[model samples]
Target: MLITIENRNYGSFKYKNSTAYVHYRNSVVAEVPIEGELVPARGKINMTTSVDLKAETMISNPNFMADVTSGSLNMTSTASLHGKVSLLKIFKFPATAFSMCNISFFILTKSIDSKCTSKIKL
Candidate 1:
Protein backbone atom coordinates (compact mmCIF):
# COMPACT_ATOMS: atom_id res chain seq x y z
CA MET A 1 0.00 0.00 0.00
CA LEU A 2 1.05 3.60 -0.60
CA ILE A 3 0.46 6.43 1.85
CA THR A 4 0.47 9.85 0.26
CA ILE A 5 0.63 13.11 2.16
CA GLU A 6 0.07 16.52 0.63
CA ASN A 7 0.76 19.79 2.34
CA ARG A 8 -1.90 22.28 1.30
CA ASN A 9 -1.69 24.59 4.26
CA TYR A 10 0.05 27.93 4.01
CA GLY A 11 2.94 27.24 6.36
CA SER A 12 5.27 24.28 6.36
CA PHE A 13 4.22 21.32 8.49
CA LYS A 14 6.58 19.06 10.47
CA TYR A 15 5.73 15.43 10.98
CA LYS A 16 7.01 14.48 14.41
CA ASN A 17 6.01 10.88 14.87
CA SER A 18 4.53 8.48 12.31
CA THR A 19 3.92 4.74 12.56
CA ALA A 20 1.97 1.99 10.79
CA TYR A 21 1.08 -1.61 11.60
CA VAL A 22 -0.59 -4.52 9.81
CA HIS A 23 -2.67 -7.17 11.58
CA TYR A 24 -4.19 -10.45 10.43
CA ARG A 25 -6.84 -12.21 12.47
CA ASN A 26 -5.93 -10.02 15.42
CA SER A 27 -2.25 -10.90 15.09
CA VAL A 28 0.36 -8.32 14.19
CA VAL A 29 2.30 -9.20 11.05
CA ALA A 30 4.37 -6.14 10.20
CA GLU A 31 5.12 -2.69 11.64
CA VAL A 32 7.28 0.36 10.79
CA PRO A 33 8.00 3.85 12.04
CA ILE A 34 9.39 6.74 10.00
CA GLU A 35 11.67 9.60 10.94
CA GLY A 36 10.33 13.11 11.30
CA GLU A 37 10.36 15.42 8.30
CA LEU A 38 9.43 18.97 7.39
CA VAL A 39 7.07 19.26 4.47
CA PRO A 40 6.93 22.49 2.57
CA ALA A 41 3.59 23.83 1.48
CA ARG A 42 2.33 22.22 -1.76
CA GLY A 43 4.85 19.40 -1.36
CA LYS A 44 3.88 15.75 -1.45
CA ILE A 45 5.42 12.44 -0.36
CA ASN A 46 4.57 8.75 -0.52
CA MET A 47 5.28 5.81 1.82
CA THR A 48 5.01 2.17 0.87
CA THR A 49 4.80 -1.16 2.76
CA SER A 50 3.36 -4.66 2.50
CA VAL A 51 2.28 -7.57 4.69
CA ASP A 52 3.20 -11.24 4.29
CA LEU A 53 0.20 -13.50 3.73
CA LYS A 54 2.30 -16.67 4.11
CA ALA A 55 2.87 -15.91 7.77
CA GLU A 56 -0.55 -17.28 8.73
CA THR A 57 0.29 -20.32 10.82
CA MET A 58 -3.28 -21.60 10.72
CA ILE A 59 -3.11 -22.16 6.98
CA SER A 60 -0.53 -24.91 7.44
CA ASN A 61 -2.38 -26.77 10.16
CA PRO A 62 -4.59 -29.67 9.13
CA ASN A 63 -6.98 -29.13 12.03
CA PHE A 64 -7.72 -25.63 10.73
CA MET A 65 -9.20 -26.85 7.48
CA ALA A 66 -12.18 -24.59 7.85
CA ASP A 67 -10.04 -21.49 7.56
CA VAL A 68 -8.24 -22.74 4.49
CA THR A 69 -11.36 -24.02 2.75
CA SER A 70 -13.17 -20.78 3.41
CA GLY A 71 -10.63 -19.13 1.06
CA SER A 72 -10.89 -15.75 2.67
CA LEU A 73 -8.56 -13.56 4.73
CA ASN A 74 -9.17 -10.53 6.85
CA MET A 75 -6.58 -7.88 7.69
CA THR A 76 -6.44 -4.54 9.43
CA SER A 77 -4.08 -1.60 9.64
CA THR A 78 -3.56 1.24 12.12
CA ALA A 79 -1.63 4.42 11.40
CA SER A 80 -0.68 7.20 13.79
CA LEU A 81 0.57 10.65 12.91
CA HIS A 82 1.84 13.47 15.12
CA GLY A 83 2.49 16.88 13.67
CA LYS A 84 3.61 20.33 14.74
CA VAL A 85 3.23 23.66 13.03
CA SER A 86 6.22 25.94 12.55
CA LEU A 87 5.82 29.65 13.21
CA LEU A 88 8.19 31.96 11.34
CA LYS A 89 10.64 29.06 10.99
CA ILE A 90 11.60 29.43 14.66
CA PHE A 91 8.78 28.99 17.13
CA LYS A 92 6.55 25.89 17.10
CA PHE A 93 3.16 25.11 18.57
CA PRO A 94 2.18 22.07 20.66
CA ALA A 95 2.16 18.83 18.74
CA THR A 96 -1.15 17.26 17.75
CA ALA A 97 -1.67 13.59 16.97
CA PHE A 98 -4.11 11.67 14.80
CA SER A 99 -4.85 8.00 14.20
CA MET A 100 -6.52 5.99 11.40
CA CYS A 101 -7.68 2.40 11.28
CA ASN A 102 -8.92 0.23 8.42
CA ILE A 103 -10.11 -3.30 7.83
CA SER A 104 -10.12 -5.36 4.62
CA PHE A 105 -10.99 -8.87 3.52
CA PHE A 106 -10.04 -10.79 0.38
CA ILE A 107 -10.38 -14.18 -1.18
CA LEU A 108 -7.50 -16.72 -1.37
CA THR A 109 -7.10 -19.42 -3.98
CA LYS A 110 -4.49 -21.89 -5.16
CA SER A 111 -3.52 -22.86 -8.68
CA ILE A 112 -4.46 -26.37 -9.69
CA ASP A 113 -1.28 -27.19 -11.64
CA SER A 114 1.29 -25.56 -9.31
CA LYS A 115 3.69 -28.00 -7.67
CA CYS A 116 6.85 -27.86 -5.51
CA THR A 117 9.65 -30.38 -5.97
CA SER A 118 12.93 -30.84 -4.10
CA LYS A 119 16.16 -32.50 -5.22
CA ILE A 120 18.98 -33.72 -2.89
CA LYS A 121 22.39 -35.24 -3.65
CA LEU A 122 24.51 -37.27 -1.29
Candidate 2:
Protein backbone atom coordinates (compact mmCIF):
# COMPACT_ATOMS: atom_id res chain seq x y z
CA MET A 1 0.00 0.00 0.00
CA LEU A 2 2.57 2.57 1.20
CA ILE A 3 0.44 5.31 -0.37
CA THR A 4 0.28 8.76 1.09
CA ILE A 5 -2.64 11.20 0.79
CA GLU A 6 -1.92 14.87 1.37
CA ASN A 7 -3.85 18.07 0.87
CA ARG A 8 -6.57 16.76 3.13
CA ASN A 9 -9.70 18.93 2.96
CA TYR A 10 -12.99 18.39 4.80
CA GLY A 11 -16.14 20.17 5.97
CA SER A 12 -18.55 19.77 8.88
CA PHE A 13 -22.12 18.52 8.62
CA LYS A 14 -25.06 20.78 9.32
CA TYR A 15 -27.74 19.92 11.88
CA LYS A 16 -30.31 18.85 9.31
CA ASN A 17 -29.23 20.14 5.95
CA SER A 18 -25.59 19.45 5.30
CA THR A 19 -23.06 17.70 3.06
CA ALA A 20 -19.90 15.66 3.68
CA TYR A 21 -17.18 14.77 1.20
CA VAL A 22 -13.95 12.73 1.19
CA HIS A 23 -11.32 13.10 -1.54
CA TYR A 24 -8.48 10.66 -2.13
CA ARG A 25 -6.18 9.91 -5.06
CA ASN A 26 -7.52 12.67 -7.30
CA SER A 27 -11.10 11.45 -6.80
CA VAL A 28 -13.96 12.42 -4.48
CA VAL A 29 -16.72 10.49 -2.71
CA ALA A 30 -19.63 12.11 -0.93
CA GLU A 31 -22.83 11.26 0.92
CA VAL A 32 -25.55 13.84 1.34
CA PRO A 33 -28.52 13.85 3.67
CA ILE A 34 -31.77 15.74 3.64
CA GLU A 35 -32.85 18.07 6.41
CA GLY A 36 -35.99 17.59 8.40
CA GLU A 37 -37.40 18.62 11.80
CA LEU A 38 -34.22 17.50 13.54
CA VAL A 39 -36.14 14.89 15.58
CA PRO A 40 -39.29 14.25 13.57
CA ALA A 41 -38.26 14.40 9.93
CA ARG A 42 -37.00 11.66 7.66
CA GLY A 43 -33.38 11.64 6.53
CA LYS A 44 -32.19 10.33 3.18
CA ILE A 45 -28.78 9.68 1.69
CA ASN A 46 -27.90 11.11 -1.69
CA MET A 47 -24.77 10.67 -3.78
CA THR A 48 -23.10 13.71 -5.25
CA THR A 49 -19.76 12.07 -5.97
CA SER A 50 -19.55 8.27 -5.99
CA VAL A 51 -15.83 7.67 -5.60
CA ASP A 52 -15.22 8.37 -9.26
CA LEU A 53 -11.58 8.12 -10.29
CA LYS A 54 -9.83 11.27 -11.42
CA ALA A 55 -6.19 10.89 -12.48
CA GLU A 56 -3.79 13.26 -10.75
CA THR A 57 -0.86 12.66 -13.01
CA MET A 58 1.43 14.12 -10.41
CA ILE A 59 0.57 11.31 -8.03
CA SER A 60 -0.43 8.64 -10.52
CA ASN A 61 2.70 9.21 -12.54
CA PRO A 62 5.86 10.75 -11.19
CA ASN A 63 6.64 12.38 -14.54
CA PHE A 64 3.83 14.85 -13.99
CA MET A 65 5.51 16.04 -10.81
CA ALA A 66 8.72 16.82 -12.68
CA ASP A 67 7.07 19.96 -14.10
CA VAL A 68 6.49 21.36 -10.58
CA THR A 69 2.93 22.33 -11.41
CA SER A 70 0.33 22.66 -8.63
CA GLY A 71 -2.89 20.67 -8.71
CA SER A 72 -5.73 19.88 -6.30
CA LEU A 73 -8.21 17.14 -5.48
CA ASN A 74 -11.51 18.87 -4.79
CA MET A 75 -14.70 17.34 -3.37
CA THR A 76 -17.99 19.07 -2.68
CA SER A 77 -20.93 17.51 -0.85
CA THR A 78 -24.38 18.20 -2.18
CA ALA A 79 -26.05 17.26 1.12
CA SER A 80 -25.06 16.16 4.58
CA LEU A 81 -25.20 12.64 5.89
CA HIS A 82 -25.92 13.39 9.54
CA GLY A 83 -25.52 10.46 11.88
CA LYS A 84 -23.55 9.82 15.09
CA VAL A 85 -20.27 8.69 13.48
CA SER A 86 -18.76 7.95 10.08
CA LEU A 87 -15.98 5.59 9.04
CA LEU A 88 -13.89 4.91 5.94
CA LYS A 89 -11.54 1.99 5.23
CA ILE A 90 -9.25 1.71 2.25
CA PHE A 91 -7.63 -1.37 0.65
CA LYS A 92 -4.83 -1.02 -1.89
CA PHE A 93 -3.22 -3.34 -4.41
CA PRO A 94 -0.14 -3.03 -6.60
CA ALA A 95 -0.96 -2.84 -10.29
CA THR A 96 1.73 -1.97 -12.79
CA ALA A 97 2.32 1.79 -13.00
CA PHE A 98 -0.94 2.62 -11.21
CA SER A 99 -2.34 1.40 -7.91
CA MET A 100 -5.66 -0.31 -7.58
CA CYS A 101 -7.73 0.54 -4.51
CA ASN A 102 -11.13 0.07 -2.90
CA ILE A 103 -12.95 1.58 0.08
CA SER A 104 -15.41 -0.12 2.43
CA PHE A 105 -17.08 0.75 5.75
CA PHE A 106 -20.17 1.60 7.75
CA ILE A 107 -21.10 5.09 8.95
CA LEU A 108 -23.29 5.57 12.00
CA THR A 109 -24.01 9.17 12.64
CA LYS A 110 -26.91 10.84 14.46
CA SER A 111 -29.69 9.61 12.28
CA ILE A 112 -27.69 6.59 11.14
CA ASP A 113 -28.23 3.43 13.15
CA SER A 114 -26.20 0.32 14.00
CA LYS A 115 -28.57 -1.84 11.98
CA CYS A 116 -26.30 -1.48 8.96
CA THR A 117 -29.14 -0.40 6.68
CA SER A 118 -27.50 2.46 4.81
CA LYS A 119 -23.99 1.80 3.49
CA ILE A 120 -21.72 3.04 0.69
CA LYS A 121 -18.40 1.59 -0.56
CA LEU A 122 -16.32 2.28 -3.64
Report the C-alpha lDDT of model 2 over 1-122, residue by residue, as the tens digit: 11121111121112334433334433454332334222211232332323333445325654445322333222222222333211222332221111123332222221311111122122
Q: What are the per-residue Cα lDDT tens digits for candidate 1 across 1-122?
A: 55565665555667765666666566666675655778676687776655444455535545446554576444555655567766578876655434344543434533222122221111
Clashes per prediction? 0, 12
How does candidate 1 score on lDDT? Answer: 0.55
Off by over 4 Å in 1: 7-11, 49-71, 87-91, 108-122
lDDT of each: 0.55, 0.28
Task: Specify the highest-TM-score model's number.
Answer: 1
Instruction: TM-score for candidate 1, please give it.
Output: 0.54
Pairs that collide in candidate 1 are none
